[model samples]
Target chain A: MSDKEEREISRIKEVESTNLARDDIRELVIETKKAVEKDNDLLANKIHRSFLDNNIKSFDIVGAIGAGKTALLEKIAEKLTAKFRMLVICGDITTRVDADRIEKYNAETIQINTGRECALNAYHIHQIIKNKDLQNYDVIFIENVGNLICPSEFVLGTDKRIIVVSITEGEWVVEKHPMLFKMSDIAVINKIDLKERLGTNVEKMIADAKNINPEIEVITTSAKTGENIDKLLELMGF
Target chain B: MKEELTKIEEIIANPNEIKISNIQELMEALFAKLKNRVDNYIGDYPTFIEPVYLEENVKIGDDVLLGPNVYIGANSEIPNYVEISNTIIFDNVKIGENFKLENCIVAKNSSFNFKNLNMKNSVLIGAANLKTELQNIGF
Candidate 1:
C-alpha cells in the first residue's frame, strides 16, 4: 500500500483501540465543517445522516419524580408527531400500564419494566427496538425511569440526551448533578406556571444550569397550561 | 424431546414455586438467567457459525465477528466489518460499514418495534447520566 493508505489504516486502528479518543470528535467537527462549506447545513445533514449511518436516535427525559415529566412528555409527544413520526417509550419498573397511556397517540410504545434497577441500560433498550421498522418514524422519546442518578450512567443510542427540570425542583438541583446536564444537549424547565407559588427563580435556575453546561439550550414551559410549548417543540427539531 | 425434558426438570426442581406476585419480577429473573446463559454460550459457541441463521434471505459482509445469541432476521443486509454481539437485528435493514455494537440493535429497523430506547443514527461518546436537571439548562 502507499504511504497515505498505510497512515489511514494505522489511524483507523488507533481509533479502534481508543474508542473514546478526541480524534473521533475532531473527525466529527471536520465532517461538519465540510458539510457546512458546501453550502449545506451540517447540523441538519448530520441529523439525517445519523439515521442512515448509526441506526440509533434515542433521547431520554430525566427529572425528579414531581417534575411533571409525564405531562411534559405528553405535550411534547403531541407536537413531535406533527413533524416527525414519533414513538413514546414509557418506563416503569412494574407495570406495562405506562405504555397504554402513550398508545393513544397511535405510535409504537414500549414498556421497559426494569424490575429492581432504577435505570434502563443500553443493552435492554437495544433489545426493545431491534425489530422496529425505523423508516416508519422520525423521533423516539425515551421517558427514563424517573430518577436523577441511575439513568444518567447508561447510553441508549439517543441522538440527544435531554434533562427535564421543573422550576419547583429547587435551585440546588442544578448544582447537584452537573454531569447529567453536561451530557444533555438541552435542559427543559417545566411547570413554569408554578414559578410564582413555588418561588422558583427562573433566572437563578437558568444561570446555574448554564454554569454547568454553557452551550445547553434551556426552554421554559408549563405543560399544564401549554405555555411556551411551541418554543419547546421548535427546539426539539420539530 | 430435549426441550421437553428440560421443562420437566424445571417443574420437578420447583414444585411450589409458581406463586410469584409480580409478573415483571418473574420476567426479570428469567431474563437474567437467559442473559447469563448467552454470556457463557458466546465463550463456547462455534467460531464458524453462520451470520444468517434462517434457511434463506440473509446477507453479511466479510471479516465480521458475530457472537452467540445474535439474531439477524430475514432480508437484513449487514455490510462489511460490523461486529455484533448478543444483538437482535431485524429484517430488511441496511447496517452500515465499520460499526461496533454489543448488546445493541438496529432497532426501529425491526418489525417488533416498540417505544423502547433507540440508538439509531447516532454515535455515543463518553457520557454519564446526571441526577439533576439544573446541571445544563441555562445559557
Candidate 2:
C-alpha cells in the first residue's frame, strides 16, 4: 500500500477505537465523498487523514460580550506556543479585528469574517482548514465571535469547546445562556483578580455554573494579573 | 461540560422543521421571524439583523423590548420581561435587564438604551443610548 493508504487505514482504526459506530463511519465516508466532489480532493484526504493523527488537539474559546475573552485569548496564545504548533481562527462581524489584535503572537492567525453571517458552521470551518496544512500544528484555537447564542448552536468539528466567562459579567450568564454553558467542554472563569472589586461571589458563580453543567471543567484565571494561567494551560492540554 | 451539553445533542438529533423553498424565501422567512421579536429591546439597538439568516435551536432572555419596525433576519429567543420595541433584533441573542432598545439589532448581551437608536452594521455589547431620528420608523 502507498503511504497515504496506510495512513488512512490507521486513522480509521483510531476513530473506531474511540467508540465511533458503524453508522458514524458510513456518514464520514459519504461526507468525505461529497467534500471531494464539491470542495476538492485535498480536503477529502485531510478528513480521512484526521482519523490517524494521534495528537490533533482542537478547542474553542467562546463567551458573551465584554467577558474579557480577547485578553484571555492572547495570554493563552502566548503560553500555548511553548509546547504546541498553535493556530488561531479569529471570528468577527465586519473585519479582521481580533485577528489584527493578536498579530504579535507569531502564530498562524486567520480572521474568518462572517460579514452578515451570525456564526461559524461546520461547513465554513471545513472550508477554512481545507487549504491549510494542519499537520504542522499540534493544536488549533478558534476565538469565536464574542456572541454566546449563535456559537452554541453550531459545531465547528472541534474536539472541545472552551467557554470563557469573566467576573464582571454576572453569575446569571451561565443560567441565562444554558446552551453556551451546556455545550462547552471546558469553562474558563476569567478576570478573577477583579472578583472582590466587582463584588462578584466567586464560589457562587462557580456553583451556578456547575449547577448548569455538572461535568464542566472549570479553571479560574486573571488575564490582567496572570493568576491560575498554568491551570488553564494544563486543562487545554498544552 | 460534555455532560451539560447533552441537551444540545437531543436538539440536534430532533431539529425544528426548516423549509427553505428558495434562498429568497429563506431570507424572507428569516426576516419575518426576526420582525416578530421587535417587542424586546433594552439598549442602543441597531438594525444589523436585516441581512442574515439562521437555522434552529435559538433562545433569548427577558426585558428585551424591541423597537419600531425592527427586523431580525434569523432564529432567536427573547426571554420574559426584556424590554425591546420597534427595533430589529438579530439571531443568537441572550440579552438581560433594564434595556431600553429601539431601531437596531442587539447582539449577544449587547445592551441598548435611550430612543431612536441607529445601529447599522455594528455589533454592540453592554452599549447604551443610541439616539436617532427617522420619522418613518415606528414601533
- Provide the lowest-lDDT 10-residue window in model 1 chain A: A39-48
- Candidate 1 displacement at residue A134 in angstroms: 1.3
TM-score of each: 0.50, 0.51
Docking class of 1: incorrect
lDDT of 1 by residue, B1-139 (tens): 2242234234323424323223223323333343312111121122211111321366666545453335555686655556665444544655555556554433323222111222322212212232121111100
Let me know the DockQ for model 1: 0.03
The CAPRI quality class of candidate 2 comes to incorrect
**TM-score of model 1 (CA atoms):** 0.50
Q: What share of the true interface contacts does each candidate keep?
A: 0.00, 0.00
- Candidate 2: interface RMSD equals 12.0
Task: Return the lDDT, model 1, position A143.
Answer: 81
